[model samples]
Target: MRLSIPIQSHYYERKRIMRLFEAKNLTKKYDKTVLDHLDFSINEGEVVGVIGVSGCGKSTLARLVSGIEKPSSGSLLYQGKPVDFKKGRKDIQLILQNSIESFSPRMKIRVFLYEPYHYFYHLHKNEALDCIKKILKQVGMDESCLEKYPHELSGGQLQRIAIARALIIHPRLLICDEITSSLDHVVQREIIELLKKFVEKNHISILFISHDLSLVHEFCHQVLVLNNGKIIEKGTIQQLYKSENEVVQNLLKAAYLNS
Candidate 1:
């Protein structure tokens, strides 16, 4: 017999009032400090872009938020509570730049996509296959690709599969760490457009990390500029364009020239 799951009214209420994810004084250090005390938050369904020059702690911040690395000092809260990366929370998902490295070469694409569903939802084989087919279709992949190994696919195709893997778990917040840096301009634009549609349709929030300021300006609702591990500037694209900060100005100039 199928069971009916009652929706939690408080979930919607919290979505209206609380941030999907929040970081307060988030710091990470190794031999040297990588990320300083950083403060940022993303509301439900908001796309927040993080941009900085190389070595500005952009990837470090993504690691901290995604729970790949622990913070030395600071707090990360998801849904108004402390984030427990160890618990394997499905609400937060992180997609990395190297999709091929993330997968097992020995395994077929179907295994990569099916494992999450089986583990998280305990679905039967047919059920898992159905879910996988749906997600693959949404990501513009066909069934033939499912039988291929990771090495058999192109970079853009693997990246889309990685995205489908993340979305299969139904995450509330998605952290993308330079996911498009490896792709060409056309592929990057396609991925960004796909993410925009996914975010709008599912009401999911994204923390997009990229060095491409032009892409960030086009895609993000708000932009955070990180310098020396701290947020040096943050604003909407228009507000940032009007700012006089040297760092922001330099980035804007670079972006303009690149475009």
Candidate 2:
């Protein structure tokens, strides 16, 4: 299914003006609240970063936005309408942190990369191979990678392939949940650079969820600081630096110390 936003009468005008995705009072709960009345938006071609401590609902928010899990009592809108998670939108893709675990053990990298193309675009085998080759190269991988299994590759290589898989569908919004948490600083920097190039070239938005304040500061145009399921602070990196909130201040201090 090649998922697409239905063209409205004023599609071009709306495209120029409206947010690509928006969450209004989005809340999720299990036995207890995971996310509480969260509100955020992503404009076209912009990168918005979400930062919080562990269990602060960062992953939950990503799930809600990408339709992996629905919000318990709030709304998620894509192009100003309620998103149907059951229908599965191809334009919103989520890349999880565990790249190795995300793939099937028995499947080759070829199958991992090809399945999305087959499912979404229904491309011919040759066409799919061509597309996969192009995407892998974009992520700085080569054709030989297609013959390998997930475990055969390094963490950085697997993560790059994971990103390649997400990009196959040409998503409007890429929700990255702790994507750099497991990698070393050097690999993390490379991945961030790749993402920066991808976002710019494709003209898409990103909802980047990370605990690394330094990475977020370097990549995102705006930042949201979540605490206890609520947005404790939000603004551009410069604005965040000027924040008087204790939580934001402490996070900045930690990021600076680590740097």
Candidate 3:
């Protein structure tokens, strides 16, 4: 018998590693199981929306994917290797759901935005400040934001700052766990557009966890419906509309009706 290794003619070992989420009997229990044996994959550069009622483990999945919480019993892989949060800490960033709680009241926006660069780039103060200015503009924030504390900013400004911090590392995957839930409708739309633009220009994949089905429909390419810690349905946006599953159909109907 002959054993052969497939050789790639165009292999670049240093290419930006692809992000992946794999689960084999992945389960989480907080009093009761919050996530059942869940098996799903989100390809690089695709947006995967997790939509469901509150307490359906949507945020739990976000936590697991972002390495904030370990699964009770299963394996997770990123770029085909076993996930080690310590090793890949900067590559995956999660923007928490609550903006007010995400940032420190004492930290000015400049410190919030530049701290990551200082830590990651080891840049002198000047270089870090320059990069911080550039990034703030990229995120649609003005230089005035640099002087304001988290408490002094509106909810939307704080949310943008949170997102800017996440992007400071240029992460390969962004796990937004209902980050827009607290903002007003117009603000939510702006933030969503900003996120979409980021994804288009960069190859970052996103797992957007939300309870708002309409918002999910507007932004996500694929939707996963979670109920009672289980995924009841998963499909493309078009497929979601055509789904016969009662939960998904009802959710779609309600979204459309409300719209």
For model 3, state the Cα shift of residue 2 in Å.
Answer: 60
Per-structure clash totals for the candidates: 0, 0, 0
lDDT of each: 0.86, 0.85, 0.80
Runs in model 1 lying further than 4 Å from the true structure: 1-17
* Cα distance off (Å), candidate 1, residue 196: 0.7
TM-score of 3: 0.90
CA lDDT of 139 in candidate 2? 96
Error of 1 at 224 (Å): 0.7
Could you arrange the candidates by lDDT from highest to lowest? Answer: 1, 2, 3
Model 1 vs. true fold: TM: 0.92
* Candidate 3 lowest-lDDT run of ten: 1-10
Clashing pairs in 2: none
TM-score for every candidate vs. truth?
A: 0.92, 0.91, 0.90
Query: Which regions in candidate 3 have their CA more than 4 angstroms from the true location?
Result: 1-19
Off by over 4 Å in 2: 1-17, 86-88
